[model samples]
Target chain A: AQTIHQWPVAEIKAVGSPLSLGCTIKGKSSPNLYWYWQATGGTLQQLFYSITVGQVESVVQLNLSASRPKDDQFILSTEKLLLSHSGFYLCAWSLDRNYAEQFFGPGTRLTVL
Target chain B: SQWGEENLQALSIQEGEDVTMNCSYKTYTTVVHWYRQDSGRGPALIILIRSNEREKRSGRLRATLDTSSQSSSLSITAAQCEDTAVYFCATGYGNEKITFGAGTKLTIKP
Candidate 1:
């Protein structure tokens, strides 16, 4: 079975600190990976998506970026965090192209204090 | 683009009762995905019903899709307190990316 794994289930950092969250897909190759953020009120927002290695697209700019270094790995990182960055971060993956039922990982909740 | 929109932003029901959630979308889609999100967790795919199909059932949950009107509905039979969660409808218009709508918060009173 294909499973998506995200690390650092929860994080707390002061403003201007660096942030990095990761997602890994097991048992699948070349899957489409996505990063999403849910605000405190639970509004789903798309942040970034990657189709393949070395290519990531930003749907909404937040002074943060994503990188797909390998086929099964996608990373979300920020050099300086803002208070607005605090939220629940989620990583999701879909199968091949058009026929994809997106599967989500556990998720990482970040608190910018 | 709000491709899929769900009605009944919140619902509260007694255990063992049947409840239905409705969703409507603006664009043409080949499939509609239903998701359930527990508090503090990522949304998980509960049901995926395609356009060619009218209705699909999984255990006690049933989902119906109507491509003609760009709408779909999910019904949960014999609800339990564990089923209390936010439900979302996502529309995939042949695009790999699925756009999710604001979810419906369902509370089951056990």
Candidate 2:
């Protein structure tokens, strides 16, 4: 069984503050990892994706970045947060090379005040 | 931007009733996926309908794809309270990555 874990289910961060959200996967090795952002009342936006360590593809740049330090560890971070940066962040993994079916994490809710 | 900008906005239905949501894509895709997102949660894969198949079923849900029209439809029968969620349609043209639509908010008036 594969499972996804995300840290800090909810957070309140001040604008211009640094942010880091972590995601870890279990029961899988070398899977495709993705980070998506779903703004309030908006659609899910793919921010970044990585097929291997030390390499990530930016789908839609929004001043945030992601890194896959290890096979099961992925981190989403930003040097400074913006008010518009606040939203629900999700981490997903897929065994399918084309990502037909992606398993998602619980997600982290961030509120920038 | 890859999906319909002002299409398939939302849908409303009653319990025990049937409803279908449609999606149209701009690019050629070999696979189409449907995801359900509950409030304050991440989206989950509900079904993956491929281009080679016309329809697929899971429990009480059924999905139909029309490649010629570049569209798809998801149908839910005997819907329950748990069915009230946002439904998103995503496409995988030929690569591992996918692009998602704005999603249709399905409100089941129970």
Candidate 3:
């Protein structure tokens, strides 16, 4: 069975600080990866998606960027954090991008102050 | 925006009761996915209904998709306290990206 792992289960950062979050998927090769963010009592918004290594697509511009450096690794980072960047960030993967069901990893809770 | 203006908000029910949540989309979609998100956890797909199928069932959960109305509904039978969570409807328009609606918070009272 495939398993997904996310690093830094939770983080609290001040405004203007830098931030980085990571996700890794094991047991599955060449899977589609996605990043989603949800604010407190808000909808889950798609941030970015990658179909292959070294390429990523932006779904919504939240001043964040994502990179799939390895087949099983995805990273989300920002140089300067804003107060509005606080939310729960989720990492998801699907077998393919053809409307397949997505599996999620234990998310990272971010608090910006 | 694909989501309707009115948010599905919240629903409360007693144990063993049945509840249904509805969603409406703006554009055409080939698949509708239902997901459940527990507090502090990422949303997990619970059901997926295709456009060709009007309704699909799994255990105590049922999902209905209506292409004509551009809407979908998910129903849970004999609800339990563990069922308390936020339910979201996601639509994929034959693309790599899927859009999620503002979820409906369901609270099951024991």
Candidate 4:
């Protein structure tokens, strides 16, 4: 079985503060990683996706960046957080392709004030 | 019906009632994914229908895909209180990213 874990389950940050969130997947090798953001009671928006280590693709630009530094780890970070950046951040993985069914992690709740 | 940019649709029904949510996409896609999202949690896949197939069923859930009409539908039979959640239909092209609908919020009253 595969398990995905996200760090800092919840956070409250001020505007202009730097932020970093991390996700790690276990029991799967070379799985495709993806990042998604969802507003409270709003629809999900895809942020970034990675097919391999060190090669991340941006699906939408929201002043946030994601990197896969290791095969099992993905990091989402920003230099400055904005009020609109506050939302639920989800990390998902699929087997080798974007079209495959994706499994998501527990997710991180962020609040910007 | 639900799609991109539309307001989130809401549906309320009594327990044991059958309900169906519909979604339409604009662009071409090879697969349609149905996901259920609980409060404060990530969306979980419930059913996936491919362009090659018209309908698929799992347990009490049924999913249908109409490639010609560019739409898909998810039906829940004998709904329970625990079945209350927001349902989203996402279209996935073979070579591109997946596009999610605005979602339908369903409330099952016991």
Most TM-score-accurate candidate:
3
Better of 1 and 3 by lDDT: 3
Error of 1 at A63 (Å): 2.5
**i-RMS for every candidate:** 2.2, 1.6, 1.2, 1.3
Scored by lDDT, model 2 comes in at 0.89
RMSD values for the candidates in order, in angstroms, are: 2.1, 1.4, 1.0, 1.7
User: Per-residue lDDT tens digits of candidate 2, residues B50-109?
Assistant: 999999999999999999999999999998888999999998654556788888999988
Q: Write the per-residue lDDT of candidate 1 for residues A1-113, one digit (tens) a residue.
A: 89889999999999999999999999998999999998865557778888889999888799999999999999999999999999999999987777467888999999999
Report, to 2 decimal places, the DockQ of model 1: 0.51
Q: Residue by residue across B30-87, what tens digits does model 4's lDDT show?
A: 8899999999888999999989999999999999999888889999999999999999
Q: B41 in model 4: Cα distance from truth in Å?
A: 1.1
Task: Name model 3 segments beyond 4 Å from true.
Answer: none
Worst 10 residues of 2 chain B by lDDT: B1-10
Per model, state how many residue pairs clash: 0, 1, 0, 0
Better of 3 and 4 by TM-score: 3
**Model 2 per-residue lDDT tens digits across residues A1-113:** 99899998999999999999999999999999999998887888888889898888888779998999999999999999999999999999998377548899999999999
Local lDDT at B79 for model 2: 89
For A46-110, candidate 4 gives per-residue lDDT tens digits of: 88989899999998899999999999999999999999999999999999955888898999999
The TM-score-based order of candidates, best leading, equals 3, 4, 2, 1
Top candidate (DockQ): 3
Candidate 2 residue spans exceeding 4 A from truth: none
* Tens-digit per-residue lDDT, A1-113, candidate 3: 99999998999999999999999999999999999998998888889989999999998899899999999999999999999999999999998758789999999999999
Question: Candidate 1 vs. truth: CA RMSD?
Answer: 2.1
Estimate TM-scores for all models: 0.91, 0.95, 0.97, 0.96
